[model samples]
Target: MSGVTRDDRVHVLGIRHHGPGSARAVATALAELNPQIVLIEGPPELDAVAPLAAAQGMRPPVAGLVYAVDAPSTANFYPMAVFSPEWVALRWALDHGREVRFLDLPANVSLVLADEEESEAPMDPIRTLAEAAGFDDPERWWEDAVELRYHGLDIFHAVLDAMHTLREGHVPDLRTRRREAAMRRVLRAALRSEASTIAVVCGAWHAPVLVPSAFPTQAADSALLKNLRTTKVAATWVPWTSTRLARMSGYGAGIESPGWYHHLFTARDQVVGRWLVRVAHLLRREHLDVSSAAVIEAVRLAQALSVLRNRPHPGLPEVLESCQAVLCGGSDVPMRLVARKLLVGDILGGVPRETPMVPLARDLDATRKRLRLKQSAAQQDLDLDLRTQSHLDRSKLFHRLLLLEVPWAESAETSRTKGTFRESWTLEWKPELEVALIEASGFGTTIPSAATAVVAQRTAEADIAELSTLVETTLTADLPVALSGVLAALDERAARQHDITRLMAAVEPMARVRRYGNVRRADTELVQRVLTGIVTRITVGLPAACTAVDEEAGRELRELIDGVQRGIGLLDQRELRAVWLSALRSVADRLGVPGIIAGRAVRLLLDAGLLDVTDAGGRLSRQLSMASDATQAAGWLEGFLSGEAALLVHEPELLEIVDQWATGVDAELFDHLLPLLRRTFAEFTATERRDIGLRVKRIDRGAGASGIRSDDTTLDHERASLVVPGILELLR
Candidate 1:
């Protein structure tokens, strides 16, 4: 059977999605046929915004986004590159004053229907044809036969014929049947309209069934689509990227090499040569030493390989292979870069400012422009100094976006010593974030308002830990209105919460807000009062919480204790430090407390200068006594040496005590405790461990009798005097 059935008023041009050769052929045939109306394979709801495709600032490689109005997450993107046949058809019709409309299953119906049980996957017609043609790779076969070569409008007829044969004995699933029925309904409507001539641009697979003779009756088509569940949907234009167009990005109808297809569609002559020159330039930009001679060699090799493969011109594979051999010196490293920068490409499309958008998206666009922050598909690092107004505003925007789940910018690690004024972020904008912005619009119109609304809603069900984190997040985002709700929730949760661990988790984040709130010029008086109350409750409950804990629980409690200590340090409040230290002492003195907890308490006391070196050494000796249980002793050592292992290197008395206790343990006990000992010492730095070992050896040889040598303590006074005279001279 032939592909077209003697329809003089209408022409069905079947083309591949995003296929450049098909695009060229469609444009050529449209000029020749000059149809009065154009129908493309996309969601019909997008017809309202389809004219934006020809807008002045609307660049190619964008997508028409259709989503359920209530459930914005249930969405679909009909992406179009400059070379996509559908895009060409739409632009041509719009430019020439011809009517254009999308003729596929509306996303509103399709999104709801997608929840139904899916049928088994159908056979791949392209793969079947490729296998019949003795090609294993379907993409290569299609590119070689149709995309790389131009056969005018006859190619579409051939594609339609192949698809018809493929469908001869094959049965389509319910979804496909429904979709095809929907397309036929639109075609019937177009036929009944006043338009004298119509051109239908659709996927090659659907073309065979769209012919007038093959189309099912309108009543049958309507019956197939009757009572299908659907929702209210909205459509808009959004920027897209070539990287997202690649098959690797999970687009079902994606092409493998969008960059190569783009080259084929846009370049006027010497496509292979220009592609290689582009590759060479990319490699050179990466500091690879590619020269003109290498580019020439690569082009020659690609042409020769194409001739051997009997191709009309050099394809992507031939050019890539030539690049690997000649330009990259047979290394794949530089070639991988070439594949990313030149093969798949990092091209991000643009949409016109006048294009319709949700309020949230419009606000964000304006905000981005005002902040002088350009959206980019490529990853970029943004360093912000919170002291600067512009940087602070940018930081607030990023934090707000994160709250709304946009995550266009992710917080990266910055140096603590860089102080509270510095923040680092990694920013890379993806097209899908537009959908997120739209979804967030339901919360509020602007970024801050939306983020605050989300946080305030979450605060109702948030636990103490989440409330604490929310408090910090609100403070960081400078959301004063949201911060009030979070702080109230935190205070209420802390008051009723009896879980000491939960209370402890709240301390650090609240402390952080109090410590760093000034850097952002945020009000922290409320946070300070809530934190003080939480600390008081923690001090009351901590000693009892530390009692009767198992080894694992002890370790976890130890970490909480460490965090609390750090939080107290951040506060730097004299009265608060005293109360916290008193609580730690009580835990240390309490009988039946886990040795790990007691040991960490004592170590914290020593670090806080509440206990002297002699007291700490005596406590260590008692803990590691042979009379003590070996396992408990090991736990004590692990906890005591947890963070400050370098103390053993600096303090000879503690090191000597630990050394003697370890050597005095019985062999069986030693074997039992070896893993624990290894684990504890493993936490120590290599240099710390080495220094401790040397100190232990010196003690064994009687050189560290007083924890210091008398002669060394004499300090080489003559050498000190020599240094002092030089220091005085420099000062003078």
Candidate 2:
């Protein structure tokens, strides 16, 4: 709330935020009643741009950019697009030779407020409404919600009121309340600034709250926000299109409908019913199926519904019933489609024929024309994905420009498929994208250069966790131009620098490609060679590097080792696995740790399942022989691990280790290890054991079920083993 409110109040124009209809109406209202001072609801950070906004050639969709004075890298933006009410209000003020001012919270403090509540959640009000109305599309649900208004006069007000209420219910937080208070403060200041009647334009939500006489003016450093920061602001106009207003986006200006509201504005004498019929005719011409007879029937149905609801004039509901009957053949089929087209029709805007320009607008037009993107018509069936993966190189500039996340070029895609790296793009030249490109140029000249610059700026401003994500994205790109920036970002995230997840983005990729010289593949050679050379210096300081990794990180290193082995060519597969084994053994020895016997066993089990499992009883028997040594134990474990036997059952002949040690070993020592043997048995569920019992026992369960039973001695031994205290404890 850091804007200037003047006593020279000019005009107060209430409007719907981003409402094209409201903008058009306000423009007319302003021209008819000229004002000297115009105030708008916006972040006061753009106060510096008041002159810029009023300047010739500036355009809408240009944001009033604000960089935090304390941290220049930290920026907050308030964007405007054509068809926005505030922009129109400003233009009218400028045309009347009046001063225009932004009246709202400044960007830095606003961002601080928003950042304090850092939650990126979307509400499900629309989704819930869609479900209630039996429509999956949120837009369609809105149509139904609004369509209900046609039933009667009482219902019409109720319907609009309900929609408004629902909208409030869905906001993540009640920022609007705070925003409205800020707006009121600005409006009161305008009144105190010497103007009798001031023009204050803002979202309709703030209209009821902006009562000047009842609301007192706020001081510059008011109690609500003593810590607020203020800056300059501006406004402009730009061409708009239908698709950009689709609500498919997260942030931007919006005009949910243009054409229908335009009709509502222009044809004051024509009732809404006749207007809808005209819409149906337009739909029919577009091959959308609304016949003239259908419109007539729809009108009849609407009148009947109006009578049924006991209303003098049809609201939105009766019109809907009429549409359903006529357009949808008594079904909610074609009517729903026509409803969207008429009510929430696409957002299409054009430059004003005679309007003062903002500087931002001229620059955007020039950039778009230079890039050969001034043509707005979109070509269908152009799949950029396949084309890129194919041999088509549009140009280095085009390829690089495509990489920037400009939301323009995003078109409505009625496609459903499960595929990676697929995105919907509309590919139009918008003033906003051009503005962004110029803004990005502050960091670097070219698009890639600008991207790198933006990354650096953001990284400089981001916290540790955010910086870590940037590192991951940079690693995925794996381009050299960002190397310095990546390292610097890594440094900023240094509090989390020791986090292996953070370090691994830099480490794992390098490790994979490091030993490429050992491979015979040509596709990955150059990158791998570079990666190996880079990591070689770091790898040379092994103990130092290992200190950054915790035990869990060590386990991940093992997994990475496995991944690297998997990546080796078929001819070198065994060699690669052996290399990892040797490396693991070396690392283990250096750390004075036990060999990874459990890891060896687990890896084997996962890889080959029961089919490759060795006979645990037989292997143990061999390993425990009096002639066996450490080497022999090692050899036996290697063989046992090489063949996976995650499951086991014992036979006396197979229990040679028990037979050899049960009589001679320290009884306590042998008992302590027995739990492991019992756990192996208990690991499998009863059903699984019943099915696989014979496999491990080498008995044909089908034959055993045939009444061929095991001997009495075997049964006795099983009972004794199952009864042991340690074994029983393990079972639990």
Candidate 3:
């Protein structure tokens, strides 16, 4: 039978699963009905695997998916977030003595439900007409009508009518309409036979069509359900968080506005306090001295924010701000990660509240523990004294390549030396892996992480040069950590051309990396540089490098470069000046051919004052030369030389190209002037360098203090940086 339910009058509840307002309404609606034959929208195959849900160790993110039996690879997962409405519906059925059934046509039928023919489909006539109606954004139109405002319970009835029109208007195909129509019949039958008010659950979009009169009714057929595929699937429970939800990841069913909605689900008065307690508890686990005072202050701040914002309940934002003020003391790094501990944690529960583990992972986990593996976060020095001979062999082999215990991994690694065997795993608990593990969960929990580990270890063993796909996938999956790990994994991968598409894909997470801020130090240099590099990479390669959906993204890349550059540029005056000077020089260098993209670079640099090299004032280089002394100044030479960044007068060709754009040089003459400026820097003198750096600094400070990072306390006021100008002068 087709895995999709094949039933008559099947009740389908269209819902935005996990949506608090929807869930609350659905629960209220369901409570009024006691359907004996409650059929929820899941793969019917899950009926065969219901035992897995109750299996002693099944976790979340596990799903009983349906695919073509002949083709196991083409499968669609029925994801189950903890807050999924389908999950709640099933639970209601289980508790109320109802015979719950998944009434979709069997997987085999639904998956391969072809009409035995193809048709040249007609386009929507209304869509053409809608152009005059200002229906430019279809999604926006839908959002306005249905995706917003959920204060009423009669919305279901309103939706029921809308589905009728939507099905005829949207799905013009007769064959597809019949499939949905048959399900409605199945829903009705389930409702009638059970003497129960049946509650049908489906996505909100589907509800408007499936009502009794919305579409044509069709009889369920065995032929309609046959010729599909099936797979033995399992289910599991996984913790979730709002931040990730905000990312709109996965199949788009993950709840949006989790922070906003969570208030409705959880107790209001205690949430902020609970969050603080959880944070303090997590900190305590990490051995941070989070005092009660911190928690109290955080609570007070949350209350203050709630009052100021006119919210009766203190929201996540308030709680977060409070936590940041009290615990972070300004830096939000630890607090964000800690919030994840409370929000989407590593703790996983089994489906059915008691599914058992998969075999391999279970066994491996048992072995690991028996071998006395510490489950706590890994540390710098770890000596796994393999007690058994085979264990010893595995350990030696692991060490031989994957471990690479040259010196650092030898239980004595430090920051100074690149350590071997000092494993750095950026851990994230994907509930899907637990589902993947549940199939193997019987074997033990180790199989999943172990299988992943084996794949990771193999890049080293098999070599990423040959296994380039693995390297790319790793990057696509989680870049900074994954790519960093792959670097070690390859130990010798060649400089494969940059796949900017793959790199840009990491922008979201990479952006998140800057949360590691030490605010007091005032040197946002690290994050600034990272953002600059990413923006630079994108801006330079865009407009053609990535094609497809990336066309839109390319425009965004230019926008993002400006945004990030602006953000970093807003640093306090001194730091901002230093950055501007350095960045402008970079623009000059990058403008040369075969260098990074520079159309945007030159404008940003010159406009930002990094290119003050054309002498806006008198000869500061000569002024500093005759008047400056090294005695009272700590590092005159260093300051002047460092200002080489500001002084980076480009060679002729690039400058001429810029002149063509900004200075309006005639094409032929512009081309001629390009080469001369290109060569100018190669022969520039010390006097020239000193004048540029001194001029930029002199303008900023009037010789107050030349500060670059020389020592932590001391700067290149006039020390080593002066040598660059001197060297350039000597060459001249």
TM-scores of all candidate predictions against the true structure: 0.93, 0.50, 0.45
| lDDT, model 3, position 188 | 58
Writing each residue's lDDT as its tens digit, candidate 3 over 1-732 gives 110123433344556645554555556666754555666665556666554543455544344554443443334456554455666676677666666666554455444443354533433322332344454322222223443543334555554444445555554354444444545655656656735355677665556555554444243433443444434433223333344453333223543344334444454357567768877887788777789988988899898987887654565667777887888777777876764555544333334433334454355446555645433211233443333443443343223222221111132323422112222222233333333433322222343344345445556665423343343333322223434455444323322326544434433333333322221111334444544454455444543442233324434544444544544444333553454346434533431211112323434554566555343112123222324321111121122222233333433222222222323434565356444333433344566745443433322222222322233345575686776685454334
Question: What are the lDDT figures for the candidates, one per model?
Answer: 0.85, 0.47, 0.45
Name the top TM-score candidate. Answer: 1
lDDT of 2 by residue, 1-732 (tens): 101123423334444455444565567656655666777887654454455555655644444445544443345444455556676776677667787777776564565665565443433443555577665333334334543333322222333244456655444344444565676666666666766556667644444345443354465325556655543322333444444443422123333454444454455564556776775776677687677777777777777776776655554556666666667667665655565666555433444323323233344345445655533523323334422432122222333343355544443457532122333444555435534543444455445565566566666776544554454344333334564565455454443345433333444433333333122121333334433332333233333444335445544554443433333322243533444344433343243221223234333433433222244444455455655443324323332333223333333233223334334445565465454434444545665445343443443223431234355544677667866775335444
Per-residue lDDT of 78-137 in model 1, one digit per residue for the tens? 889998888999999999999999898778888888787495454456767878987654
Prediction-by-prediction clash tally? 0, 54, 101
Q: lDDT, candidate 2, residue 521?
A: 20
State which candidate, 1 or 3, has the greater lDDT: 1
Best by lDDT: 1
Those runs of model 1 whose alpha carbons end farther than 4 Å from true positions after fitting are: 119-124, 134-150, 248-251, 414-418, 701-732
